[model samples]
Target: MRKVLITGAAGFLGSHLCDRFIKEGFHVIGMDNLITGDIKNIEHLFKLKQFEFYNHDVTKFVHVPGKLDYILHFASPASPIDYLKIPIQTLKVGSLGTHNLLGLAKEKGSRILIASTSEVYGDPLVHPQSEEYYGNVNTIGPRGVYDEAKRFQESITMAYHTYHGLDTRIARIFNTYGPRMRLNDGRVVPAFIGQALRGENLTIFGNGLQTRSFCYIDDQVEGIYKLLFSDYVYPVNIGNPDEITIKEFAEEVVRLTGTDQKVIYKPLPTDDPLQRQPDISKAKEILGWEPKIGRSEGMKLTLDYFKAFSKEELRKSEHRDFV
Candidate 1:
């Protein structure tokens, strides 16, 4: 059997990736510092012989004993609320943590795929963000902490590939939702579901006019998996291209959850994108991948998953440690 190491193994995305890899029959090594990642997300795999976990931060040092064939570097505080509170840690992980993983990949002769994000576009001047467009970003803005960090992450990864000949892939992941997502993660999808479950009004920022595209978790994992094995060494945008306004998406959530609640509005955060969508032409042409799930189908599945959690479980909590 082949071997793989997954950082951020206990996060929403990381946990799902673990399930996929284990399903593929790889001996999976799961690592996280439990800073932002909850141990509960991955505890189910503890009894499995093919799965072993490490409570270690990738920003410091990463050591995986024996043969390793692949590294999926998904270890970062991804949400807006997350990166804002833990800006320095976010920068460190994207820079230092990524560097550590790249070095480990070189030592192990493993192909590595690091998770990038749509935030790199930084309130994109272009519509339906493609891989080639240089983003419109404010380096000193409040959100720049996450945006520039990912920008730097891409820079160093590409450098390693060019200078050191390390096998590398970068995935520009988009908004993905499904089970195991933190109800309080502050993203629109889960936040709406959590509010609906708790009988609270759905909160929409910025008059709900801004646009975004969301991808289902299964489709996202499939895209990343294909990108990992593909010969395309450049960055690939792996997300659904279906775009919708925040207001429309909120209405869908209210309808799906059968909640008769008023939609509330608030001022949007600084540096938040006015429009966001992925131009997946390269992913389709090169990887033979496009999102197979539609918004209604994906939303229903996600709402059902969130419905499983009790109102008490959906209650808001203070932000804890930074990863």
Candidate 2:
């Protein structure tokens, strides 16, 4: 059995990756600091004989014994609320955390995949962002903490691949949604769902005309898996290409929840991207991967997840309101 190390193992995407790898019969080593990630996401995996959990922060040195075949560095503060709340940690995890993981991969002679984001295409100048597009980003803006960190992470990761001839893959993920997402993470989908379920007004920043493409979690994980095992070293865009305006998305959520609540518009946050979509031609050509879930179906699945969270769970953590 191949041994794989996954950082941010307790996170939404990390936990899902763990489940996928374990189901494939890989011996999985899960690592996280529990800073923003909750243990509840991967608690069930602890019972598996092939799964091991490490409560270690990846920004520090990683010391896993034995030969490792693969490493998936998914450790970073992904959500806006998360990065804004812990900006330094976000930067450190993306910078130092990626460095530490690359070093481990070098020592273990393992292939590594780093999770890059569409945020690198910050407030993009292009409509449907392709990997070749040099993004229009404000490095000194409020959201720069996360955007620049990811930019740096990708740079250093590629440098290692070039300088040391280390095998590496970069997946520039777009907006992904499904179960296990924090309700109060300030992402539009979960926030709207939580508000609708609680009979509260759904908040929409700006005119709500800004567009975003939502990829289901399963599709996102599948793309990552393909990129990890494939020999593609260039960055691959992994996300759904179906674009929808925020207003349309809000209406869909209201309709799905059967809620009478209305959307309340708020002033747009600083540096919020006005338009975002991914061009997945590279993923399709290189990895033969494309998102399989439709928006309506994915939203319904996410709403059902939010509905499953108990009222008591919501009361404990404001973030739990969405599930």
Candidate 3:
């Protein structure tokens, strides 16, 4: 059996990746700090003989014994709310955490894949951002902590590849959503779903004109797995290209939830991108991967998860009232 290490193994994407590897019969070692990631995500995996969980932060030196075949570095503050609250940790994980993982990969002669985000193309000047776009980011802005850190992550990853000739893959992931997403993470999908379930207004920033392309989690995970095992070295975009305005997304969520929530517009945050989409021509040609799930289907799955939570909460409240 091949040995694989996954950082941030308790996170939404990391957990799913862990499951994927484990199901494939790989001896998977999962490492996480439990700072932003929750244990519940990987608790069930502990019973599996092929899975091992470690409560270690990757920003420090990562010392995993034995030869590893693959390392998937998915550690970082992925959500905007997470990076905003813990800027230094976010930067350190992307920088120091990435460095440590790259060193480990070199030592073990293992193929490594790092999770790079589309945030690198900050407030992009291009409509559909390809990997070649240089980006139009303000390094000093409030969102710069996450953007700059990812940019540096890519830089260091390429340096390692060029200087050491290590096999490396980078996936420039776009907005992804599904179950296991934190309801209060301040991401648009979860935030809208949570609000609609509670009969609260769905808040839209800046006249609800800003657009985003969301990829379902399963499709995102499949794309990443293909890139990791493939012989691709350069960054590949993995996301759905279906673009929709914030207003349209909110309406869809409300419709799916069967909620009568009002849409409330608020001023946009600083450095919020007006448009975001991924050009996956390279991905299509190289990896033969494209998102298979549509937004409507994806939203229905997400809403079902949230609905379960809403019912649980309501049951608890009613019990208290009866008491």
Query: What are the per-residue Cα lDDT tens digits for candidate 3 across 215-314?
Result: 9999999999999988989999999999999999899988888889889877788899989999999889999999999998999888887777855663
Where does candidate 1 stray beyond 4 Å? 316-323
Ranking by TM-score: 2, 1, 3
Best by lDDT: 2
lDDT of 1 by residue, 1-323 (tens): 99999999999999999999999999999999987898889999999999999999899988889999999999999888888889999999999999999999999999999999998998999998999988999999988988999999999999999999999999999989988888777787888887778888888888788999999999999999999999988999999999999999889888988889999887778878899999999999999999998988988898888777755576653122111
Cα lDDT of all candidates, in order? 0.90, 0.90, 0.90
* Per-residue lDDT over 186-304 for candidate 2, one digit per residue giving the tens place of the 0 to 100 score: 78788888788777887888998999999999999999999998889989999999999999988988889998898888788888999989999999999999999998888888888
Q: How close is candidate 3 to the true structure, as a TM-score?
A: 0.96
Q: What's the lDDT for candidate 2? A: 0.90
